[model samples]
Target: MTAADTFETILEMRARAVEDLLGSLLDERILPGEIARPARLLQAMRHGVLNGGKRLRPFLVVESAGLFGADQDAALRVAAALECVHCYSLIHDDLPAMDDDDLRRGQPTVHKAYDEATAILAGDSLLTLAFDILADEATAIAADRRAALVLALARAAGAGGMAGGQALDLDAERTQPDEAGIITLQAMKTGALIRFACEAGAIVAGAPAADRERLAEFGSAIGLAFQLADDLLDLTSDTTTLGKTAGKDVAAGKATLVQLHGPDWTRRQLDGLVLQARELLKPYGAAASTLKLAANFVATRRK
Candidate 1:
């Protein structure tokens, strides 16, 4: 089969794998002096994570780690951990105080499915559980490797990364951001974890630093393409196709690269970025075809 087709098939498989693991993991967590799982919180977390989506971050982790001959099982665990963080952020992002959205992944968002307080707690639980999963021995990496993973995840999720970028995004509604500021905000908010996804594979396999950097660069490049494509989708697509409220970005007056550059210019830039991302894997030849296909997918996906 062609690499593009393979990318779609593998992506579907991995997303299903993530859903299965997340379901079982949610059931097994034990608390001190607590005999049963908190049903509401668990349900909310489930609502947030199990809604069925592309699971792109995990795909990147698996593919990047695969490049280094890393153990597939161990890489899957790490991918799951990264996914917990991604889901947590989505839950919180949909809260009444954040994006104030009522739907996510085509279902009621965590807050709407449960309540605001439950949504907060569910997000909190998933965020911590990610670290818990990383600390567990089942991940099979050495302590130092886990530590690096933790640190990387922390920076990407914390103020220097997604959180900071989100704050900037909120502020941008009030004041226009320059193109550079918009790029930086997008990099942190959307690109940081993606960069980690690519880098984590190398860390898991103990690949050479140079290889890790190259994959990380590829991730960063595609992350930009992903956001640009998303912005374009918001501008061009309707809510039914997007599975979330469309035109919200424009309504919110958010500063996006698309806002600065217009659709034609943004699409051209996306093409260049996708090419740049793919080129980083040229030295690995056929081994990198999946990753190159991933970049193309990010640039061209309709929703």
Candidate 2:
């Protein structure tokens, strides 16, 4: 098979693996410390997360760790934890108070499938579960590795990261931010977790700090590409194609790079970002091939 085909194959395999792990994690079985797993809350959480997407963040974790010959099982657990955090963000992002969307991944959003309160709790539970997974001995990583993972994820998901970025996004609706403001907001809101996804793999592998930094920079480049592609899709794609409300960005008057610089310019910028990402991974040679393709995938994704 071709390299692109290999990338797709690996991506699909990793996504399926994550899906199964998440399914098991969200199952009705209660762990030792938990008194009970509320049925409705679990159902809401599953609804928000179980609905299909690319599972790209988890895939990144697996792939990045693989580059360093890290333990696959440990990497998978880390990937799953990162996915929990991502799905939680999505659940809350679709809330009535946030994007107010009714759909996600072609399914009713958590708040739509369940009550608003249930959705909120579901998001909260998943967010908490992420750290739990990271800290749990079941993950089988060393203590320091686990601690590093926890700290990185906390920073990526906390007020200084994704949540803070969301707040800025909400504010942007009222007062449009400048180009620099938009970049910062996008980096925190969208790029932060992605950066962690890549860095987490290196951390799990106990790779050198320099290698971790390289992967993080690669992630930042592709994260920008991902957001740019998403913005372009919002402008050009339909709801059926996007699997969610399309043109909502325009309707909300949200500022994006695509809006700031026309689609043609945005497309060129995406190319440049992908090139930058690939260059960052060049030192790793062919081991970085999958990641290079990932950068292309992020830049060119339709949804």
Winning model by lDDT: 2
lDDT of 1 at 38: 80
lDDT of 2 by residue, 1-303 (tens): 977788888899999999999999999999999999988899898888888778999999999999999999999999999999999999999888987888776678888888899999999999999999999999888999999999999999899999999999989978789999999999999999999999999999999999999999988999899999999999999988887778978888898999889999999999999999999998889998888999988998777
Question: Over the stretch 166-213, how does candidate 1's per-residue lDDT look in tens digits?
Answer: 898888877688889899999999999999999999888888989989
TM-score of each: 0.95, 0.96
Model 2: CA > 4 A from native: none
Estimate every model's Cα lDDT from 0 to 1: 0.88, 0.92
The best candidate by TM-score is 2
Model 2, 142: alpha-carbon shift in Å?
Answer: 0.9
Query: Candidate 2: lDDT of 264?
Result: 98
